[model samples]
Target: MGLFQPDTDIFCHRDALREDYQPDEIVGRDEELQQYIAALQPVINGDQPANVFLYGKAGVGKTACTRYLLSELKSDAVEYGVDLTTIRTNCEDLSTSYQVAIQLINDLRGSENRLKPTGYPRRQVNEWLWDELDSIGGTIIIVFDEVDHIEDDSILYQIPRARANGNLKEAKVGIIGISNDFKFRESLSSKVQSSLCEKELQFPAYNANELRTILRQRADTAFYEDVVPREVIAKCAAFGARDAGDARQSLDLLMEAGDIAVEQDADQVTEAHVDEARAALERSRIVDGVAGLTQQGHLVLYALVMLHEEGKTPTRARAIQDRYKIVCDRAAVDSLVPRRMRDHLNELAMLGIASRVERNKGEVGGRYYEYSLDTNPDLLLEALDETVDMVGVTESIRKRRS
Candidate 1:
């Protein structure tokens, strides 16, 4: 009775509420959501609360959950006449203490330019941060997403420790930090850990069934009538759970599958549509990974991918250096040759974009092998194309045609 069965269109644009549709919403985590709400009740009712820590893997609803709860809590706090001011900034973006303070001040003041005027100095920024919190005379919540990124511990220590140090004038401060580093929890010792981890919530990756349920809810809201089959949603759930169980990735796959069906004029979404969706999402992932690299790192990776695509890949530092030289000339940037390139290559290796392999000289002689891009060269290049300011090579090959 349907327009097309699962086999009708390879895939259907799910009428389900699309996640990438807007402000990354929280699909699941009902229990976690409740816990977060309960924990914040102290501050919401005008009592200064303990700092909280939320940690989880990528796409496991860490940012989405905390953000959603915070959004809702903000509205409730305002209605209750709580002068609750909050500022959320990712530590990864603000790697240093100064940057964090700048963002915090800018948020409190509601002016990015006035965060710190010329020649104010970092110490002054810190002072200003404390002053602003103290002046509020109410509850202030500072949420640092990816708190592990903060190289300077002062930001964490000073805020929660202000009262203990007798530095508070009136207002009480609480911090809610979010991080994905599994080992980061153990890294913190008594004092700072005690304060920040007052309430700890670990968000685990969603299982297949859980993802399916989530997608189903989203699909029902986002897609048209009965266009997407249950099979397609399950496929996405299984894929996400198997591979790092990233919800964001699954969401991307679902959205892309819909676009594919739309392009082909398919009346119904089928297994084939799911496959196409996965492929498109995979390519997008590679591109996003590459796009995030710094300019020099981007060039190094681009050169490596170019070499590998042509069949001259899995190259040594010297060989990669030679290839990199061409990329440099093309980009019109003065480039490094061997030694300098090694550092960049190592950096790439650390990022999981490039991998290092050990080779032997003569039957386990002095060891030295080669380097290779961990991801597909073509995919990485395309990914970089989206982010890089001036990427020339649309397509590069390692070998010539017959």
Candidate 2:
């Protein structure tokens, strides 16, 4: 066998299909682009920047559109002789308001002058942020992507009301809060909500045709001319649209399908390649979702799978709690209280590992939630077995069956 395949030129520029790739153009977001442009128009006209909020499901074009417009705005600002400075930070790991402020201060200051990641009081951090903004002394737009990750809404309130509160004297600041959590906006305090949501835009998921267009555009640049066929692109789009209209998913499917074709020594990516890629993606997703759970979460999920295997699915929380207790006992770990157990179950449901259906018997019976495995029970068991020690768990399950 040869060391390398003779025909492995599946992708031209694979980076084009990646999540971080910032394309020269954004597709299927014309309306959104216009709305975003309108929101940032003030900065172009040398007026005070507007606070804008963007909310949507993951893999939508929220970040992409924001980046595209911000880039264009920065370029135009230079041409128009506007002193525009933009700061962007992802709050995924930086949760608290103080942490976000420290990050912003460090971002404003060069790395040489950056402060430590911790040890600052919230008030001191806010003072430092104000000082940095005052030093910039121009139109400053700060974008907080994954803003919902922030533990406190203090930064949101502080930034938008900086001028009115007299914290910012020279610089005019704008806040752009981006989040995939829809409820995050409403969860904010009324004051923070009123200011941060001054102008709000929602990015809806892309449909099949829209995803197809997006895939085609990236395919032209990502893969060889004939490597990805029209049907393959359509299939990828169909899958993404059927699920969540996630453009990222569509692009990922295309990229992975091409890689699979290359791995199999196939001449080109075909429907079979896409099918294999879909299976691989699903497996990886389930494993990642399972791996992210806490130990108790794993116990709860394992219990659900065991119940499902015994044809006890669509079970209520109380039944799952009982099974969870057994699994925990077998593993020699203490089980959580029923209330906390319910919280863990809800977390699992949020992570897409489990499903919760609300049930109400007529006025005679009270309402209850029915829980079931959202994914394949076999797959869930496989993921758990691989990620954690299931020897005792499997033995306990077997004993119960016997």
Top candidate when judged by lDDT against the true structure? 2
Per-residue lDDT of 1-402 in model 2, one digit per residue for the tens? 978654547877889999999889999999989998999999999999989999999999999998889999999999999999999999999888888888899889977678898876778888888999999999999999999999789889999899888999999999999999999987899999999999999999999999999999999998878988899999999999998889999899999998898888777899999999998998888999988888888888888888887889899999999999988887889999999999999998888788899999979978999998888655666687776684366555556766
Judged by lDDT against the true structure, how good is candidate 2? Answer: 0.89
Candidate 1 residue lDDT tens string, 1-402: 977555333333343434434344555688898888888889877887778998888778877776677778789988988887777887787776677887787777775447543356867777787787787778888889899888766678778888777777687889999998877878775677888888999898899988897777767655676777899999988998987687777777777777777778877666798898887766766666666667777788878877776777687888888878888888889897577788889877756678899888886567776888776655665566576545466543423322
Which is the leading candidate under TM-score? Answer: 2
RMSD of each: 6.7, 2.6
Which lDDT values do the candidates have, in the order given?
A: 0.76, 0.89
- Candidate 1 displacement at residue 137 in angstroms: 2.8
Model 1 regions lying over 4 Å from their true place = 1-27, 75-82, 186-190, 287-402
What would the TM-score be for candidate 1 when compared with the true structure?
0.71
TM-scores of all candidate predictions against the true structure: 0.71, 0.92
lDDT of model 2 at residue 302? Answer: 80
